[model samples]
Target chain A: MSENSTYAEITEAIRAHDSFILLSHIRPDGDAIGSQLALGHALEAMGKTVHYINEDGLPDNLSFMAESQRIQTPPAEPLDVQVCIALDCATKPRLGENALHAASKAKLWINIDHHISNPAYGDLNHIDSTSPATGQILYQLIKSADMPLPDATRDAIYVAVSTDTGSFQYSNTTAATYEMAADLVRRGLDVGTINAQIYDSNPYRKIELLRSLLNTLQLENDGKVAHWELPYSVKEEYNLKPEDSEDQIDLIRGIDGVVAAAFFEELEDGKIRVSLRAKDDTFNACETAQLFGGGGHARAAGIRMAGPISDAREKVLAAISNAIS
Target chain B: MSENSTYAEITEAIRAHDSFILLSHIRPDGDAIGSQLALGHALEAMGKTVHYINEDGLPDNLSFMAESQRIQTPPAEPLDVQVCIALDCATKPRLGENALHAASKAKLWINIDHHISNPAYGDLNHIDSTSPATGQILYQLIKSADMPLPDATRDAIYVAVSTDTGSFQYSNTTAATYEMAADLVRRGLDVGTINAQIYDSNPYRKIELLRSLLNTLQLENDGKVAHWELPYSVKEEYNLKPEDSEDQIDLIRGIDGVVAAAFFEELEDGKIRVSLRAKDDTFNACETAQLFGGGGHARAAGIRMAGPISDAREKVLAAISNAIS
Candidate 1:
C-alpha cells in the first residue's frame, strides 16, 4: 500500500467522518497545537463534532492565540469518535499514553505530519517531509478540500508556521510559506498584534535562563564548535519550564566563525539532553548525534545520554570536535 | 509643491538622467545601504552610470551581502552626475557632510524613503510612510516603473526590508511585505544563505555587550518599565562598535508585563543617549522623547541629553513611569 494520502482522499475521509478526536505530541509547540486547531476548527465549522486533546494541554505562552483554550488535556474517559487524527507528531508514542487512550475508541486513524522521520503509522497518512510545518499542510489540505476557513484556522496557521520557521528566518522556510502568510494577512490576520503576542511577550525567567546559558558558553575545536551546559541546579534556580529555554541555543549558534553549536542540559533523570545545530551541511549535526544513539536532520539534532553532566559533555564535545575537524 | 512623486514621475526622471549618485544615512544600516544598492543596481542594469556612496562606509557585519563592497565612503573629489538620490534617510543632514559634497554636482535630487518623519528635501520626493521599509518602496517602484530587477537589486531589496523590519517581525510589516518576500523567493532568491548572513552571523562582542547590558537591567514602576545602562567604559573595554549594541533593548522590551523599555548609554562625547521603546500606545515614546528635544514614532524614540548617565536615567525613567501611570 502506498504510504501517502492525497488531499482529496483525506478530504473524502473527512467528509465521511461524523466525529473526530485530534491529538498532537507531548509538550506541544505552536506547530503541534496550531495544526490541530487549524484542521479541527475547519471541521467544526462544517458541523462535525471535534475533540481537541493533547498530553500537555495548552501552553501558557500560547494562551494568547485566539480560541486556544479549546485545546484540552485528555479527558478521564475515551472520546466516542469515528475518526482519530494525529497532527504534527512524528511517532505514535509522542502522542503520549493518556492521549492515545482517550482516542482509543476511534476505528479509523489518520496521521498528518511534516517530520522526516515520521512513519506512516495511520491507516491513512499524509506525511510531507518537504513541508516546513504541519500547519502549512493543513492550510493546503483545507483549501484544496474546500473546507471552511474560519478565523481560528487563519490565526492558528500563521502562528504554526511563524513559530516553527523562526519567523521565516530558518532554512526550511520556502516561498510557499510566505505566500501562505500573505494570504492569511490578506484575510484580515492582525499580524502586528499576533506577532507581538507570539514573539514579544516573554517571561522574565527566560532572560535569566539565557544569561545562565551564556555564562557557561565555551568555544572548542579551534572555535569551530561553540557549546554551553545547563546543570540541573540552574534549571531549578530559574524555575524554567521546557519552553523557557526554547531557541536559546540560537545565541551561540549565531556566533561568527562557529560551525556548530551544542547545548547540553542535565535532565532530572540523570541523563543529559543535548541539542545540536550546524551552520551548514558540512558539520552534519545528525551524524554527530547518531554516534551517541541520537538522530535528527543534518543541520539540527537531539540526543539523550547517561550523564554526570561532565562526562556527557566530554563525550558530546569530543564527538562534535571530531566531526568538525 | 506636493511632496509625493508617483511611480510614473520617478520613472520619467530616471529615464531622463544618465549619471546618478546614491547615498544613505550615516552609520549606514541594512536599509540605508540596501536601498542605495537596490536602486543603484537597477539603474546600472538600465545602462545608467551610478555611484554608490555612504559617509561612514559599510559596517563589518553587512560586508557579506553580495556586491556590498561597491558602497564606498565619499571620494576626495565630487563626481559629475545628473541626479543625486538619497535612500532611507529621514533628513538631508543625516547623509553626512562629506556625502553631500561628493554629490553636489548633481543638478536634481530625488528623495525616496519610508520614514514618517522625512521632510521631503528632494526636488522630487516619493515618501510613503505607510510602507514598513524603504526597500519595500524600491521594490514597488522598480516594478511599477518597469525597471530592470538585477540580481543585486533583488538581494538588496530583501536585505533592506528584512533588516529594517526585524526580519518581518515588527508591527509595521504588512500583508504586502510577505507578498514581496514570496515574489523575491520565487525569482531565485536563496533565502537560507542570505538570511544566515543577515541574521545568523553575530560577532562575539555583541554577545558580550548583551551580558554587560543584562547585568545592569532593572525593572521599575511595578515591573511595567524595564531599563538598562551601558557605560562608555564597558564599550571601550569590549572594543565595541555602535552596531554591537544593535537591538539589545529588545531583550528587556520582550519581558512580560513590561509596558516600556529604556536603554541609557554614556556616549564618548559625555552625552547620554537614551533609546526608548513603548510596548503599546499607552506609553507614547515620542512624546517622552520630545521632552528632551528628540522625536520619533510613538512606539520608539531616542534622545541625546546632558549626562552623568545616572541623571539621564532618572529623567527618562521618571517620564516613562509617569506616562504608564
Candidate 2:
C-alpha cells in the first residue's frame, strides 16, 4: 500500500509535516526544477517552511521558471526540515551523493516521480509511470490536498508538463496531459509567454551549431539512420558551451523515413559522446547505449567512449544496426 | 439572429439536411482542411453525403490528414448537395468563383468559424472570436449533434487546433485549448506521429535555405530588429522554391531580445518579398506590411515591394520604429 500510496496519502503525509526541504536532481531539467518549485510554492502556501535546493543550482535555460531565485545550490548551513521530498529523481544518489547532509537531516523521506525505473526507496512513495511528467504527479498531489491553485504554481507545472512532453508534441502526451494544460490555462497560465521563454528564445550559438550540423548530415542504412558528427572545433569556433548542443538530434530524427538517429560530439577529453534516438522503443536505444557503458530510456539514449570520432561513429552505427536488426 | 446561431441550432440544421458540401478557404491551411474533414466525416456518419472540396487542393504537407484522399480539388463534375457549409473561410470570396457552382447549389448555407473577421455570410452561423481555432468551434458543433466521436474526426480536429495555435505555442492557446487537446488524446490522438508528419518533416531544401538565411543574419535598431536577406541566387544554388523558406523567420524571431524580426527574399518579379513578425501586436506587423501594399495579422504579416533589398530593409526598419515609438 505504501509503495502505491495514493495522492491522498501523500497529501496527508505532507500536511502532517511542517518544515520541508525540496531537492531536485543534479543538472536538473525543467521537470525537476519546475516540479520542485511548484511543490515548494504549494507547501509554502499551506503554511509550511519550504527550502528548495539543487546541487548544480539552475541553468539559464530554466531560470525563468524559478521564483525569486528560491532554488539555492551549495545550500546554506544549519538546514532544518521535518520532511525531505525528492522531486523527479530516480534514486537517492540522484540528489547528489556529496550533498547528502541536506536530505539525510530530515525526519521523513518521500519520493514522488513519474519514471517507471524509479526504485521506491523512500518510506512512502507516490509514483506513476503513466504521467508524462513529474509536475503532473505534483498537480495531483496538490489537488488531493485541496490547496488553492495559484497562478504561479500552475504556470510552473505547465512548464514541467510542456517541456517534458515537447509542448505536447512527444509520444507520451496523452488526453490527461492536454487536460492539465487546459486547467492551467483556465487558471491564468499565459501559454504564449511561457512557451516563448522555454522554446522561442534560442541563442545565436544554436544557429552556428546548426550550420556545423547541417554540413555534416549523413544518411545511412537506406536512410534508416540519419546522423552527424560534431567536431569539438565547431563548439570552439561558434563560442558554444556543451549544453548548447542539446536537441540537435531533433534535426536528425525528424528526417522522413528515418527510424534511428545518432549525434556524436568530440569531447575535449579525447572521448566521444554519442546520443541515440529511435522512432520506436522496440529498437532498444537503452540496450544499445548500454553496450558502451551508457544508459537512457528506450527512445533516447547516450554513451561516452574514449576514442577517435571515427571509431565512436563506427561503433555507434554498429550498435544501432544490431538494435534495429 | 444568424450571426449568433448557437451550436444547438447549428446541429439541428445539419441533421435536417440530407447532403452537405463543405467549402474551405483558398490555399487551405491546416485549420481550414481539418475542420472541413472533421465535419465532413461527422455528416457522413449521420447518413448524409458529404463533399469536402477546396479550390487549390491539399498542400503536400497536409495530405496526411486527408483520410484516403477524400478531399478533392476542382471537385468532380455535376456537384450537388442539399447543404453548404463554409468552414474557416473569412468570406465567400475565399471559396473561389470556380467553387461557387458546388456551394451555390445547396439550399442551406452554414458558416462555422473562430475568426473575428468572419462576415457571418451563412443563413446560420456559429462564430466565436474567443476560441483559438475553427476546429474548436467544430468540436462544439459535433458535441451538440451528439455524434459518436470517432478517432479519425478527433485526430483531424487535433491537427486543426495544434497547427493554428502553433502546437499550443501561440498566445491564443488558452486553458480550453489544452483541454481540447487532452480530450483528443483520450480519444486516441497520436500526437507524436501527427506532429512529426506536420512539423518535424523538414525537407533538405529547408536546411539549405537556413544556411543562406543564417549566413546573412544581421541586427539593427539597437538590436531591436534582427533580420536576414535571401537573395534569389541562393534559391537557384540550392534548387529551392519559396515554400522552403516558410519557417525561416523562426530562426530570426527566436533570437533573444529581438523584439521585431524580418526576412527579405528577392522575388522573381524584380521585387522584394518581406515577412515580418512582431513580438507583440503593439508592434503592428500588419500596419508595416500595409505600407508595402500587403496585409496580415498583427503579429505576422507579409508584403511584396518594388525595391532593392537595401531600400526595403531601410524603409521597413523605419516603419517598425514608427510603430514601436
Top DockQ hit: 1
Give me the displacement of residue A63 in model 2, in angstroms: 2.2
Candidate 2 ranges beyond 4 A from true positions: A5-9, A66-68, A76-78, A147-149, A229-243, A266-271, B66-68, B76-78, B231-241, B267-272, B280-325
lDDT of 1 by residue, B1-325 (tens): 4459898998999999899999999999899989988998999999999999999999888898778899999998999999999999999999999999999999999999998889999999999989999999999999998899998899999999999888888888898999999999989998878888988988888888887888788899888999999999999999998877778897788898898999999999999999999887778999999999989999889999999998999888888888788
Candidate 2, residue A290: how far the Cα is off, in Å: 2.0
Taken over the whole model, the C-alpha lDDT of each candidate is: 0.90, 0.81
Measured by lDDT, the strongest candidate is 1
The DockQ for candidate 1, computed on C-alphas, is 0.73
Evaluated at residue B264, the lDDT of candidate 2 is 87
Please state the i-RMS of candidate 1. Answer: 1.3
Docking class of 2: medium
User: Once model 2 is optimally superposed onto the true structure by TM-score, how far is the C-alpha of residue A283 displaced, in angstroms?
Assistant: 3.0
